[model samples]
Target chain A: MELVELLKTVELFEGLTQAQLQRLAEISEPARYDKDTVIFEQGQQGDRLYIVGSGEVVVRVGEDPRSARTQVYLGRGQIFGEMALLDGGPRSATTVCSRNGTQVYGVSREAFTNLCKSDTAIGYVVMRNMAHDLSFKLRHHNLTLV
Target chain B: MIYKVSYVVSGGRHPGAIMNEYERPQLGDRVEIGDKVFEVTEVLEMTPPRGDFQYLHVTVRLVDENENP
Candidate 1:
């Protein structure tokens, strides 16, 4: 699938115009990983966010990689590692390629921020959608703990 | 057919919609999120298919503690 069309399925990129999605696509780099490859380890400094293009990726967390537990399974059209891109923080979890030939489209913080600077509309919509998703996640996590 | 699912587990929605395995998950199948494994109890259409993509909402519950992975 075209990058722009894949971006359309993601909730975070919701509301972007075709032109805006095209701009994001242009800056994106599509990468493929073999099964079991560690895409990024928890606590590592990260500047890029990835959108899965095919196959599967797993997000897990633990102080030690061996002890880490599966956090979520991400597949085509889903975004992982977004928090780091938005905040310049260390990765909160380890994301691994769970299936062979898994592919992801990555956009670095520098490139994304540059695009955002050039088009505030992109920044506004993406940030707003991200906030909405984060709030839902926070709410769900807190409730599940009870 | 491409079936993408958003899972709601143990009475709360998962932070994000997370699904895209080649085989569609059916009722009684197991799902994992975070450290928890859930059993699918209900499946509903979240939205109609968009081109080749079909969206679904899967409601599940934590399996008995003894059944955990």
Candidate 2:
């Protein structure tokens, strides 16, 4: 699917118009990962977020690979690395391509920040969506402890 | 109310933690820890062979906050 279409399917881009999505698409680049490829390691400096185009990606925690635990598995249309991209923080976990030929679309923090700066409307909607996503995750995490 | 719980990863134990008891956690729940959000894809409850301790193993999948599919 096209980048705009893919972005529309992402929850972070929800409520964004086609024109805005097109602009985002222009700033995005295609990425690919081979099976067992480490997309990013925990503690690495992060500056980009990825949207899965195809295949599966696994998110893991722990320092040792031999004992590393899988945190989550991502499939098509899923997004990752946004937390680092938004906060300019180190990655909290590692990501690996679990399936061969995994494909993704990536957007750099610089480009995304610039887009937000130039278009407050797009920024507002995207930020709001991201906040909503974070809230949902927080709620879920809290529930697990219950 | 807050619920007392233990946080386990790959069979190792992190410090026990507490969370609010608003929405009960179930399979497929999405959770955020630090800079990542993961989905609760699996939950495994275990009892040691000779111990009185019961363990809950929760497996989560990393997911995009905005993904609909």
Candidate 3:
């Protein structure tokens, strides 16, 4: 799918207008990762959010790269690294390509922040969507602990 | 109510496992299958029943506890 169409399917971009998505698409850079490739490591400085374009990516947590545990598998339309983008914090988890031809679209913090600053409407919608996504994950995580 | 759940370990050799899904498997749920402990990291999909409205089908991905801990 086209980047805009793919962004439309992402829960984080849900409710965003086509024009907004197009702007986002323009800022995004396409990337590819081979199977078993470590995309980013936990604790690394994070400045980008990645949207899965195709293939699978796994999120892991732990200090050891050789044995870090998997935390989740993200497929098409899913996103990662938004926490760092929003907070300017280190990466919370490691992400790796789980499939042979994993593809993603990445948006840097600078570009996104600039976009948000230029357009508060896009900023509001994007932030709200991110909040919703994070809240849903937190809720589910809490439920599992109960 | 008890529900059956199946999960696949991302980038691992294990073929995954089936277990009861009581609490609705969420990210970070520690699950045990045989001697291996896995952490629930993602919910792949959930399928509701067709006609009679029975159990829902859920697929999840997990990673070994050794890696997560």
Q: Which tens-of-lDDT digit does each residue in A1-146 have in candidate 3?
A: 77887776566776678899999999999999888898998999999999888777777788898887656556666678999998999999998887777889999999998999988888998888788557545543333333
Interface RMSD list for the candidates: 5.3, 14.0, 9.3
* lDDT (tens digit, per residue) of candidate 1 on A41-123: 99999999888887788888897887786666776767889889878889999999988898899999999999999999999
DockQ of each: 0.23, 0.04, 0.07
What CAPRI-style quality would you assign to candidate 1?
Answer: acceptable
Instruction: Give a tens-digit lDDT track for model 2, residues A1-146.
Output: 76787666566676788899999999989989888899999999999998877776777888888888766555565678889988889998899987778898888999999999999999998788777556544543444444
- Please list the residue runs of candidate 1 whose C-alpha ends up more than 4 Å from where it truly belongs after superposition: A139-146, B1-4, B8-17, B20-40, B44-57, B60-69
The lDDT leader among the candidates is: 1
CAPRI-style class, candidate 3: incorrect
- Give the per-residue Cα lDDT of candidate 1 at B58: 71
Error of 1 at B27 (Å): 5.3
The prediction achieving the highest TM-score against the true structure is: 1
